[model samples]
Target: MRKEFLPFARPSIGEEEIAELIDTLKSGWITTGPKVERFTAEFAAYVGGRFAVPVSSATGGLHVALLALGIGPGDEVITTPMTFVATLNTIVHCGAVPVLVDIDRATLNIRAEEIEKKITPRTKAILPVHYVGQPADLDPILEIASRRGVAVLEDAAHAVGSEYRGKRIGCFPTTSVFSFHPNKNMTTGEGGMVVTSDEAVFEKASLLKFHGMDRESWKRFAKAGSPRYDVALPGFKYNMMDIQAALGLHQLRRLEGFLVERERLARRYDEALAGVAGLILPSRVPYPVRHAWHLYTPLVDIDRLTIGRDRFMAELKARNIGTGLHYTAAHEFSYYADRFGWRPEDFPEAHFVSERIVSLPLFPGLTDGDQDDAIEAIRDVLKAFRA
Candidate 1:
């Protein structure tokens, strides 16, 4: 057994990130200011987006995107139940109904075919998440949305560098949100960005991001300017701070390299876990695009396993190896079940995958020896606990 504990994920912060953050602090402007603006512009270029708005988190981005799209009460947004609750919560925050479609068992993404079935006159948008950083089959989804005249608001929190076909994840005419959480493919010390090609949504989301403060504030509060400003609309205080953007600036610069390391580690996990009994590795997504490999999640085959997912996780921990549950079916949560009258059987694929999925330790900072130890621990646990 290894003599130390390993976390499921860890941020790969470097000297450059620390130096940039210090520079932001020393510049005497720590809130939303020039650094934040620069980060947004640079990120826009990185993803080939026409506009990018930095926010406090992906949840805030989603909330702003839905609001900017004019999704409100009586509107319905189609999404997946395999995603984090934030996706559903943001739809609810917009006062719109979140209509969930079951995931494709192969991809763990919202099934594009099932989407058209759920559309109604009230369906105003299709919110699909790139589950586990694998690009959802988006051409069909986009075509459906176009034909239906409904917007596509992608929850791309797990995918910053991911692409669909030849286009980047956030480069479409529709809006998409990317997370910069500490555990994400790259860290901004907690932040997110909204990318869009639609100028109208971009303008509205910016105005709604910071208490609806007009862009004139930057001019008004200048060295020689007036202090007058106007609030165009009621908005949330969800703007990203300079400190977060300072981290983001460097993170984005290093993201491509980080992704390279992430992919290498993910592939190593695939090879290491191959033919391991009672475990099913993540798929290599048959889609024609690059996977950011944000997570290396494998399903624990309970039918062939001796222990339940929870027990398996506990055993991994006792051996000083950590693991994570990417998600439990969102609809099966008590709040959603009670509020929407949802049941486990309502989405059989989501329910089954939720119970078996576990995110093993895979990060840029993870050494080959660390990963080897993790593999051994998993094998040991399976051998010792096998039915």
Candidate 2:
């Protein structure tokens, strides 16, 4: 057994990040200010987006984006069941209904063909999640939206560096919200960005991000600015702070290298675990994409084992290996079930994946030796648990 436990994910913070953070602390302007502005601009340039708005979390970004797009009461937003609850919760908070779509078993993304069938007169937008860093098939989804005169918002929480066709995710025509949580490919400590090409959406989201202030509120405290400000509308407190941007400035610069290392680790897992009995490894979509490889989730064939998925995770934990459950089917939750009257059988593929998925260790800091330890531990657990 390995002497130390391996965590499922960890941020790769360097001396530069620490130094930048210290500089921000000593600069005496810790709230949202110059650093946040620089990070937002750099991130926009990096992803080729026309506008970028920084927020406290991806959930916040989603909330603002939906409102900016004029989605509200009686409106319906199409999304996948194989995602975090935040995707559904944000829609509900906007007084909108979330229409669940089934996922492709292999790619674990929302089925594009099935999406068009669910569109109704009340359907306001299509929100597709890029599951585990792979971009969803957007060409068809976007086509459907454009033809139908509805909007498309991408839940790109797990797709910071992911690419669809030849362009990066944020470069697309639709609005994309990215997470900068600690576990994500890049971290701004705890922040997110909403990137879009629509000028109206960008203007509304930027204003709504910081209490609906007329302009950049941080400038009010500067030497050449006025303390007076006006609120055009009531909005939430979702602006990203300068303290968080201190980490983001450095993280954005190193993101490309981080993605390269993560892909290396994922390929290693693929080569080592291929054809391993009782394991269903992740598969790529047929279309061209540069997968960010945020999470290496594989399903355990529990029918061939004595224990269920929870116990399988417990076995790995006992052997000094940590794992993560990326999500449970959104419809399976009590709130959605009671509100929408959904059943586990409604989306069979997502339910199956929800019950079996396990995220193994995949991070820039994970060494090959560490990977070997994880692989060995997994094999040992399967051998012991085999029915």
Candidate 3:
């Protein structure tokens, strides 16, 4: 065992980000201002989106996006049970019912064919997450939503640089939300962005991202500013701060490089762990796509091992290597079960993926030596139960 513990993920922050943050703080405009504006513009350009609105976090962005889409009580949002709970929480907060669908066992994303079976008159939107940074099969999902006149909202919290069919995830007309939390591929400390091509959705989301101010309320405090403002609608407090944007601006500039390094590291993991007995590696689809590779997850075949997934994690921890469970099936949680009457087998694929998935170390800053160490540690842990 190594003397130090290796974590599953860590933000790659450099002096540039620190320097930019210090400059923003010393400029006496720490709240949302010039830095936020520059960051938003740069982000829009990076992802090829028409407009981008920064917010407090992905959860806040989803809530505001649904509200902007006019999704409320008596509405249903089709989504997968394999995503983070925030996906379902946002729907409930918007007063909409979450229609659960099974995942494609390979990609662990909501299956496109399964979506049509769930659409109803109350269905207002189809929300799909790019699970673990692999873009969902959007062509079919888009076709169904378009035909049914149902809006499509992308929960791209795990996929910032992912591409679908040669187009960036946010480049199209759909409303997409991204997360900048510390554990994600990029970090703004705690922030997110909402991108859209629809002028009406862009206008509404930008206005409502803050306190429903006519324009960005941060502008009201500048030298050339208006003293009064009008509230056109009731909105949440979700605007990103200049402090957060300070980090995001530098992060955006380094994002492509970060993604390149991440790809290299993920490939190394694939090469090192390919066909290890009783371990299922992350799947690669035949369709053309660019994966951001936020987390390289693989499932453990517990039946072949001596212990359950929890004990496997503990064993790794003993060797100073940390692991992460990306998620648990949302429907299996007590609140969801009691409310929706969901059984463990309602979505069999989700339940299977949820119980076995384990996120290993995959980040831009991890070196080849570090990866070798992780592979060795995993091999040692699995040797005891190799069938």
Candidate 4:
């Protein structure tokens, strides 16, 4: 067994990120200033989007995006049950009902085919997550959204550099939010960005990210900026600080390299664990896509393993190998279930995946030897549990 506990995920920060952070602190202006602007611009270019609005977090980005789209009490936002609670939480926060659809068994993403059946006249948007960095089947989702005149707001928290059908996930005119949480594909400490090509939505989202000010509230006190500002709408305080953006600016530059290392590690896991008894590895879609490999989650066959997912995690922990539950079915949560009367059977695939999924240690900084240690630990756990 490895002498030290292997964490499920860790941020890879180097001297460059530290230096940039220090530079931001020394610049005297820290909250949502030039570094934030530069990060937004670079992020916009990275995603091939016309505009980017950096925010406090992906959850904040989702809130602003829904508000920008004018989603309110009567609106219903369709999304998946396979994602983090924030995916559904933002819908409720925006005064909209969260309508969840089942996930595709292969990709663990919202089943695009099932979306049409669930769309009522109140359905104002389809909020699909690029689950675990695999792009959701967006072409059909976009087609449905276009025909229905509903918005498509992607919960791309795990998909920074992910692409679908030769096009980047966030490049579309519709709104897409990317997370910069410590455990995400890249780090901005704790930040998020909303990307879009639609000028109107961009403007609305930008305003919503601040205090609903017509112009950024941060600029109002600056010598060159106007002291007067207009509140176009009631909005949340979700703006990203320059301190966070300082890290993001450097992280964005190194994103490609981060992705490369992630892919290599993921392939290594696949090769090492392929056909392992009681394990089901993640699968890729046939479309031309570049998966960002945010989390290497695999499903355990409880019946074959003679123990459930919780026990498996405990066994791994005892062996000093940490694991993570990416999510339990969002709809099956007490709040959602009580409020929406959602049952486990409502979305069978999502419920099943939720029960079995476990995220292994997969980060840009994970060494080959670390991976071997993880595999060995897992094997030991399985064997001990079986015995």
TM-score of each: 0.98, 0.99, 0.98, 0.98
lDDT on C-alpha atoms for all candidate structures: 0.90, 0.94, 0.90, 0.90
Candidate with maximal TM-score: 2
Candidate 2 per-residue lDDT over residues 1-387, each given as its tens digit: 988989999999999999999999999889899999999999999999999999999999999999999999999999999999999999999999999999998899999999999999999999999999999999999999999999999999999999999899999999999999999999998999999999999999988888899767679878899999889878889999999999999999999999999999999999999988878899999999999998999999898889888998999999899999999999999989999999999999999999999999999899999999999998998889888
lDDT against true structure, model 1: 0.90
Q: Which structure is stronger by TM-score: 2 or 4?
A: 2
Please count the clashing residue pairs in each candidate, in the order shown.
Answer: 0, 0, 0, 0
Candidate topping lDDT: 2
Off by over 4 Å in 4: none
Error of 3 at 195 (Å): 0.2
Residue lDDT tens for model 1, 1-387: 899999999998889989988898898778888888899999999899988889999999999999999899979999999999999999998888999999988789888988999999999999999998999989899999999999999999999899888788988878999999998988788899999878889989998998998864555777987897789999898899999988988889999998999899998888888999888888766778889988888998778877899999999999999999989989999989998999998999999999999999988889999999999999898777767
